[model samples]
Target chain A: MTDRYKYMEDLLNRFFSGETSNEEERELYRFFAGEDIPAHLRRYKPVFSYFESGLEKELNLLTGEPAEAAEPFRRAMPKRRIRIAAGMAALALILSVAALLFLRKANAFDPYEGSYIVRSGVRITDTSLIRPEIEATIQKALQQEERANRLLLSLSASNPETRIEQIQRRINRQNEEIINRFPNEMKESIRRIIENK
Target chain B: MKTRHLIAAAILLITGSLSANLPAQETLKALVKKCESMDNVNTSVVRNRNKQTKKLEKEIISLNFSNNQALVNEFIAAFEKDKLMADKEIEGKNNGKKTLFYRFGDTSYSFSQLNEGSASVSVIQKDEYEYEE
Candidate 1:
């Protein structure tokens, strides 16, 4: 045992000087793991145990075992999920607001939204009260335009002789209709009277 | 292909500007807007609805002003200027009252002096005339 202690003291000096081999350092760790260490070596036992623990952690990493390095990443997973969920919720809110505005614009489009009327110097914009007047005004304007169209058509028609012939034909057709309304015996007499005229 | 696209775009822009600068319609609209603030004027705008679907269709603007020769002349001048751009024009006189009608594209305008102490100008859809027929 005195020889073993002397050898371990030599290895400790080599380790502190950074010149100890891997096998010598491992032997020193094994020696510190035994409870039979002498009272004189107790203070150095703690330093060897620390190195043993550090070597075990490196072996765990090489052997694909669970490691303390992954603990922080595992803890951050839930936070990432929460951030993504919050971003989606914000996007949904903005989309809904945009949709609402578009619907309002579509629903509010009206051609006659600002229609109004004036009566005796009073400007009235009440749609319900002026509805009839609006209709009447439109009707009057349409009628006036129709009259102008008819007058133009008449003035642009063929010569007076053609117009007179057309009028004569219309009168004859009217007479024929009137005669047809009479009885069969009186129809012939009515037609003959019309022909004589 | 890019030069062809550029030429097409230039043509489209020129035609768009030319159509937008139709002076007659612009002048009439400006006149109507100005008359809206006048005390002696009554204006009415009516949008026609489809008989079957109830969908809003064409619109008509009617303005009635107290008989003023100056206003009548202004409208006539606009009508005459529009006549140069119109597809059709008609002028008629009945019982000393003169009426003028002009059609541009799908829009028609009429200016009439009634027997009453009122003169009216109407901007209506051209289809309204066909509807009467």
Candidate 2:
């Protein structure tokens, strides 16, 4: 075959392999439609004839538009449909994934659970429950003070010097009781001070 | 031995009942009445002035016999005889300034004397926790 025919056959092969552009395909169609065709490539006549008939039908469908001009619109229709379907599928997948995550987070939540704290870090759940307990403690302190007062007054009623001893004892007792009843952190510090002393 | 125990229990019950029947404020009221009878003393009562969680009665009796040691002694004697007793006492002196402080049952009494022989006594009663507003 001549070099030009060989080149045309190569282009036709490339077009069948979908490696040719629109302009290149147009060149291939014009070459195949020409009557000056070689003998060995004659077997490709039916295939080229089919392409010509398809182009004519497309021209008719496009209302007298050129076959080359109508080719892009025909090719773009299927591409646009595929793009729309792919976009819808992607949106559906995203929505389902978001819904699954939201459901998982909701199931992990517990509404009734709560925390309890007192002052700073001492956890005491019900304040009403702790109120009576604290009040009872203050009452005991009051009673202790009352008892000491009564003893001191009676002793001082007869002799004032007796108050000195009673006063010291009562003071010591009060200090001990208060230190014992103090919070853990305060009691620890107080103990450290006493030990150091 | 069981009959003796029962008799001892009966005696305790009777004494307890008798004591409970006696008015709790009898001694304090007598002391207050005696202090009120003293001349040259002004007595004033304040109720619920603090507006805190508890309402208390504060009995203030100002003595005009400030420099009289005899009157002070009498007053101290009367105070010691009352139901309330002083649980604490603080004394300090600096530069001819003298101060005395006494704390009783939710009550406090302080007496201070300056260098010029001017003396003043103040009594304060702390409120107990109350439920009502």
Candidate 3:
């Protein structure tokens, strides 16, 4: 640990440059691990031990050479760790892509047609149910028509001069009923009259 | 001799009146038959009539219970179709003895249903607006 700072700088400079391959790096670490190393370099030994972690395991698996290096070797430790890390990264990438696709589909909407629409007093929708209020309204209309018709009939009985007025009144009331009952037909007839003129 | 002549004259008068106008009344049934069978009269086209119930031919736009029937029909059949039914009715106001129809509309008119009798204009969807006439 004495001259550890100077040796570490030298090793670091050599480490960063393209000068040391994995074998050379391991040899440097082994040299630092030796007990007889100068006190100056002993403190620097721990830094180079990091090199032992990455090197011989994967290379020994490929070359079939590490079996003789240690008698009770656990075998190719670094290669297994690298494989496990790579598999985890791949799985995470697949899940992220799947989640992104699911979110995009969930937000998509159909823009072509529409559902029910309500406007002003009239509300229209898919279901066919008539309201009680509408029935009451229709009843009021019928009552009015009945009164108008009765008035015109009585007036007709009273005098002959008002016959045309009576005819017009009767026609008007009938017209209302016709339009109310069968609007489409009545409308067509009126249109015909106008066009003829 | 005078009694016999009176009876004959009455019969002749009835026959003349019947001959003069009976065809008009009969024409509606014929038109109905024609409409029922004719491929040109599409029920699907009139199905878009909201709040209005309709039975129309190619040229007609029947306004229906929704209070637009008379106006719709008159606008379409009378103006557009140029065909007339002898018996036609419209919802209108009482002016003196005549019930004058003020519900006038042209092709540009809006056929809409509202709570009050106010119509909001809309650009009809394509293919939704069909006129055989």
Question: lDDT scores for all predictions?
Answer: 0.70, 0.53, 0.39
Query: How high is the TM-score of chain A in model 2?
Result: 0.29
Model 3 bad stretches (over 4 Å)? A1-75, A110-197, B1-133
lDDT by residue for model 3 (A41-146), tens: 5666766664465445667768987634854454567677889999999999999999999888655422111222233324343322323323332343335434
Docking class of 1: incorrect
lDDT of 1 by residue, B27-90 (tens): 5667767776777777777776655555656677788887667777777777764454554568
* lDDT for B7 (candidate 2): 52
- Name every residue pair that clashes in candidate 1: none
Q: Please give the ranking of all candidate structures by DockQ, highest first, separated by commas.
A: 1, 3, 2
| Top-TM-score structure, candidate number | 1
Highest DockQ model number: 1
- lDDT accuracy of residue B93 in candidate 1: 77
Fraction of the real A/B interface contacts present in each candidate? 0.33, 0.00, 0.00
A1-197 per-residue lDDT for model 2 (tens digits):
49989898888889889999888877877877888889888888778787768757776777975666777999999999999999999999999999999999766442212212233223454534554444443343345445535655675676666557767655443433334444667776554443333
Ranking by TM-score: 1, 2, 3
What TM-score, to 2 decimals, does candidate 2 have?
Answer: 0.27
* Candidate 3 TM-score, C-alpha based: 0.21
Off by over 4 Å in 2: A1-197, B1-32, B50-64, B79-85, B91-100, B112-119, B129-133
